[model samples]
Target: MQSRRSRTSISISQQRMLSHSMTGLSLEQQKMLYYVGVDVGTGSARACIIDSMGNILSLAERPIQRQQLKPNFITQSSQEIWQSVCHCVKSVVRDSGVPSEKIHGIGFDATCSLVVVEEKSNKEVAVGPDFSNTDQNIILWMDHRAIEETAEINATGDKCLKYVGGQMSVEMEIPKIKWLKGHLPDNKFAECKFFDLADYLTFKASGKETRSFCSTACKQGLLPVGVEGSTEGWSRDFFHQIGLDELVEDDYRRIGGSVKNDNKGKNFLSAGEFIGAIDESVAEELGLSNHCVVGSGVIDAYAGWVGTVAARTDVSLPALAKSDREKVGIDRATGRLAAVAGTSTCHIAMSRDPVFVDGVWGPYRDVMANKFWCAEGGQSCTGALLAHVLTTHPAYTELSQLADAASVSKFDYLNSRLESLAHQNKARSVVHLAKHLFFYGDYHGNRSPIADSSMRAAIIGQSMDNSIDDLALMYLGACEFIAQQTRQIVEKMTVSGHNLSTIFMSGGQCRNGLLMRLLADCTGLPIVIPRYIDAAVVFGSALLGAVASESFDKSGAKSAISASRKSSIAGDLSQHNPKNSLAKFGGIGGDDLPSPYTAPSATASTSQIATVGFPFPAPDDVQEEQFDEDEESGSELNFKAQSKWKKDMEDRMKGRSSDNGDTMWNVMYTMTGSGKVVQPCAESHPDRVLLNTKYKIFLDMADTQRKYRQMVDAVE
Candidate 1:
């Protein structure tokens, strides 16, 4: 089973003998270069290097270890996490000297964790029997050792456990492959392989044993449900009801019969052939360039959500632009949920439909937004419950020695000692003693609603004065118990269908602005905030290496090989799927649709298109840079005009009026505003698109808004 280029053929034959002792150097020749991303978390193993305008240029890390043995077993060592992912990809190409044949495409992301891989003859075995057999295999993503095989696959109430929200999660990989086929039944023929630490690091870099629907639907619950047609793969009667029915024999070849494809699909392979070379024995032990292109893998939070939403062009030009200028609803398949928040919090989201959201795990497909369907759900501990309410209180080492003699950081000297003991107070009166300190949060147990890993933690408003002002009101009630457990999974993903509007946030408790205004006053919405916060996962892994090197159409032309061929494009359409509706615009009913479950712009005339809603005060003085290591230093992406902040978002919704008797119909009848607006009746597309100005501002609103202000002051 050794193949990621013959088990990293000594780093691609010692970087092809150092690229024939360095030939033709035009400053290390570049037509296009660098894109590696590897991730593997839950205790380190990173690698970044990015370029092609999404920027990063260098980064590395190693760690991994994780043992525990009892108190609910944990183990790891797929040969010590692939030798700590080849010592963090040979220390991020020896601290980015750049010339690994000018690196092209390579991606990877991890921590859905579960690698085992066994079949070796010429070498490599031991997934562990302890006693330093040393090959140590791998299990970790907080390994619980399948708590009774995840309560016997949730006692088979299975309808694929209602697409994961119904529960099975002993943190996935079908309860760690039914606790390794019922305790290693003689090492079950030393199980050829299983993988998921980003499909065992793209089967250890391109010996390509494929499998990433972001690791078969977030750690093998695998359900795309439907995007088109639907021969729903991976489910041999739900893996013979969790016994893993020998991974449906032959064709599955022990988990990797193929299906990797990143951006669009098919074996499209281009981070330009892993920026060509490297793996010639990992290019003679990381000197690099056995032909450089090592890409097509992702998972470290979908390569940090494609390097933190590739420096916003409404979220990286609708996912790395130029597919005839891609744009559709929810910015082409909803993403935003992000969250990250340090010391545990993931959340995520993304949708082009498949939604299963119960307690949330995922519909997964395309991992981090390609064709869509992600899900996720987090809070295994929000900033470890604000460092367990400031280091288990009792005035945490005297408020960390008066915040280390005022060099600040006991949460900035406890917010300057609650702003000098609230001298006429207001951070909303210290967030109302953080609503009487109630945090029952099962510490590290309840992963998603109640995937309960030994239900432990409990705190509920204690007392008898342990001052430092009761540890600053129990650290603002553990940051409002991590924003009321992410507003109880946004009220269970709005009853499991999801139409959620805003919340983007990032890690390190999003550098706490009173914990991002108490998660925007406990999820009432509006959070966006990514004007480049330490490269959101390295600009979402350098926009997946500029969409695997087509480099946003400056004509390198490949665009990650989108697999087509099934188009006979029929339409009598009505199966009625307005994509899991919460309708912020998605329609198709007909005969001026006002019902048949509303849409065709929810009933039409929309001034043949010219809309605009609340656009007020648009300019925030643009200038948000951070494209490090220079691909011409970031943000020049105007993508062909529209600014003056896109025509002041069309004169702030046509200079708002309804002649004072205000209602604006409960702010356009809330689904969080901007409710009815849909366009694309196609008079050659863009006439100031926002679905043709939200269907000509709701057909110049005569049904009210006071007969659209006397039909716009009788056409002015």
Candidate 2:
């Protein structure tokens, strides 16, 4: 095909002339008005036009191309991504009819991937010849080109690796760069520039090669500075052992020199200062902003988390009154858990102190919206798991044909058939049976707790029936699996000091009512599905711009409000009435204490509730002696209460402790990179089974033999 530019240049030129005509206006009319936020995802790129109010005026999208080289080697052209970004910006601005001079700021968020650029004398060169001159730099985020390098790095047992979930994923740039060095040494020598995709976007827009701490902290193994006792940004001994010592350049030039904390007060580089006012020369070519600010960007998932997590709501009803801002699901509290469920699901929770969970990624300080430490746990295929569950069934082909004939989706058809069957079975206790046909979902390998990528999926029970009745059960099972996995994460986190009260869910999957209901029933916690699941990333980027402008600090609001407003904001989406909307799993009940995150099944014989956090007895749960309020008035309430409680408990336990010989103790373990595992003390519980899920134990025959011996002795 002929080049698009070679053919579309004339119209682009005319559009450029029209854009510049506004600069001729008077000085008073010259306003530092709007800002643009660009978000690039796996399949496409999007640009948003927003004024100072955080309203999204107009947004545009342009699809980018991806090529799978080898089985695991995924590649993309830096040129293609840059062009798509520019195209989107121009489209949104043109479609909005907003004056170019009015756009004062710009921000970007993209997938965190490696970009490889070769040096010829000094200028960066393309990786290959096909579209070499125009587009041969970026390595896509999903690309697993460095699996071997990642394994090798992990083998080093580097202290720095602990910051990123004990294992260094091949998806990061360091491993990819290492792969390039060993596999393509000639290219490695010729290469002068390497960047995370987000950094690359900023470089393309503002002519700067700076890196953000968000990228380095999460992906590039940057040993955090100011933590006291850390020598360099990375561990020098660790890097030298990994055979890529050169990555730690003296001036930090190859990746970045300066770190721009967007949360701190840092203005985005003005349009003119970087890309030269998006002038006629460029405007006639790409048809973009002349006065718009082009901003430094962030990873895509981080952007999504930023947009929707913190919002001040005015819902005055008592139903939402139980919503504690200090709770995990509400915006008023810090350290709340927000799970973004899409093709995959990212579970994010922040903390005041860095608490590292064994298999979960991060202790990433200041990475997510800043101020607090972030811990990210996720399921690799959340929505994708649901898709796989529906599509691979034997009845899928017939269902597809029937749905096509009816001009509706297979899911819609399946739901209709399911509802009809449920109506017919209304007299029977079929819904009870439906709940038992549970799905133990590990379909896409476990992303957290188990981090076992090679583990295959299993279905506990499946009938040969291909009717819609079977579909409803199968669908319910899928939702249950999602909730179950989340429960496991909550269990582990609670043990380590996270007090989760609610789950804030966002993403397209939150639209699935059956899934949402199952989540409620399974987790037993109130699920807050944000009004705007799709446009969260844009809101997040706009918030970043607002923070940079000192808006949050000035208002004492803690969260920044966007300057430009979108057509319809994300927070305004309403829950669809199920009478007309799709059939869901479960729903909102009366304002009681929202079900616990892991509640026991009502039908199950065991009355035990799956309480999180080390399964310890709460102080209040224990019997305490009563004290006269007037007599204890001189003493503090807490101290006096504790004193009386301790005396009463001691007297009660005098003979019980000696007779039972059962003790409840807490054991805390912290894994260090030096291969020294510290267990302060090991506690034995007689009343319950104490299994430390934090450590890896092999189930091989020899290990089984050892465990059997311990079990037998414990029982004795």
The whole-model lDDT of each prediction reads 0.50, 0.51
* Model 2: per-residue Cα lDDT at residue 636: 24
How much does each candidate deviate from the true structure in C-alpha RMSD?
28.4, 21.2
Local accuracy of candidate 2 as per-residue lDDT tens digits, 221-300: 77545432454455667767988766656645565642332323222121111111222234333354433333345677
Q: For every model in order, what is the number of clashing pairs?
A: 61, 23
Our model 1 lands, by Cα RMSD against the true structure, at 28.4
Candidate that would win on TM-score: 2
Model 1 clashes, total count: 61
The segments of candidate 2 whose C-alpha lies over 4 angstroms from its true place after superposition are 1-32, 119-136, 185-192, 258-291, 313-333, 369-371, 401-413, 427-438, 466-472, 549-716
TM-score for every candidate vs. truth? Answer: 0.29, 0.66
